[model samples]
Target: MSFEIRIARQFGERTIAAEFASKGGLTALFGPSGAGKTSVLNMVAGLLRPDTGLIAVRGTVLFDASARIDVPARQRRAGYVFQDGRLFPHMRVRDNLVYGWKLAAPVDRWMDLDEAIHFLGIGHLLDRWPRTLSGGEAQRVAIGRALLSAPRFLLMDEPLASLDRARREDIMEVIERLRDELKLPILYVSHDRDEVERLATTIVPIG
Candidate 1:
């Protein structure tokens, strides 16, 4: 599926505007902090209602202000990964990964849980809680969880922001593999120029 976004909104006193079409591949949102990179992503994910615009994914109208069509966030069918790996502290890795599927209404179950587990190299951490895993492990598990949701598009906001250089590189490789193997379109947010060059098929340079 593809994505097209044309939205305008206000952030504090400044107007943030963006218009772009994204084919199925990784699109990097590259810019300085506070450039409204995440804001644009939020609109596409139906997390933020735009003041005026339209958001379409594979020709499906997720938001169309003129038509008064606004699909709620949960129904957007887009997966999101935050900067901090927001895995449940007490839940085991396996439990956290399957949580998405459980919450999904009419879950597809199209993603093979076993395959996702192995792909992220988290098979060994399945029995462990989030706290026991390293930062890299947590992010990997988070990615796996998002994939298992059967999302049409994945939004990753600084997925490597808090990690050290080595850990960041490790996760980046995993992301590269996932993008190619799963054939998933990813909207990846990053301030690092190197990471953008390494992973992005198209760059949305903010600011």
Candidate 2:
């Protein structure tokens, strides 16, 4: 099992929390708009500090409030693919992809540049600007960037939310390949029932 999460954060009078121990493979956080599903992902990725509880991936501890342990975000090595595919606008595709790869040591980088481009099918977009790429293309580039980062785990926050059905299907196929072949533990956030049913091996409800 890769994910073992039991976390809660306070937002004034409101408290957001999620508790689940995955059996491995892809895990989805299923819930509504204000459910704080993304918050849980943030906590796991070391982006947001939880007021209490533990967040562990595989056997490594990323956060444990009781133990006074909190791994920095960069050290967590989480490949986060946001809904908008937030690629750097000023940089070309090639530069954006190498950003994280360069930060990682040669040994820590699990995949080389050519390999990630080939896997994500973004070979052609290497020179294109983010503005020129379609929605699907941008998302593909985002995934490629994540892969090149050599992440131990993945956090996808509504990856298909902004795409049309056709484009969504395209990204879905790519995600399926990642889920099956990469074998990395993925924490996916989505409000769509169909998306969750199709991609997640384990479902954790949040609200």
lDDT of each candidate versus the true structure = 0.87, 0.93
The digit string of per-residue lDDT tens for model 1 on 1-207 reads 477888999877898888888887798989999889989888988888899999898789999999999999988878888889899887999999988887775655568689888788788888998998888889999988888877888899999998999998899889898789888788889999999999999988888
Off by over 4 Å in 2: none
Tens digit of per-residue lDDT, candidate 2, span 134-190: 999999999999988989999999999989999999999999999999898999999
* TM-score versus the correct structure, for each prediction: 0.94, 0.98
Against the true structure, candidate 1 reaches a TM-score of: 0.94
RMSD of each: 1.6, 0.8
The CA root-mean-square deviation of candidate 1, after full C-alpha superposition on the true structure, stands at 1.6
Cα TM-score of candidate 2: 0.98
Q: Kindly give the stretch of ten consecutive residues in candidate 1 with the minimal lDDT sum.
A: 103-112
Error of 1 at 139 (Å): 0.4
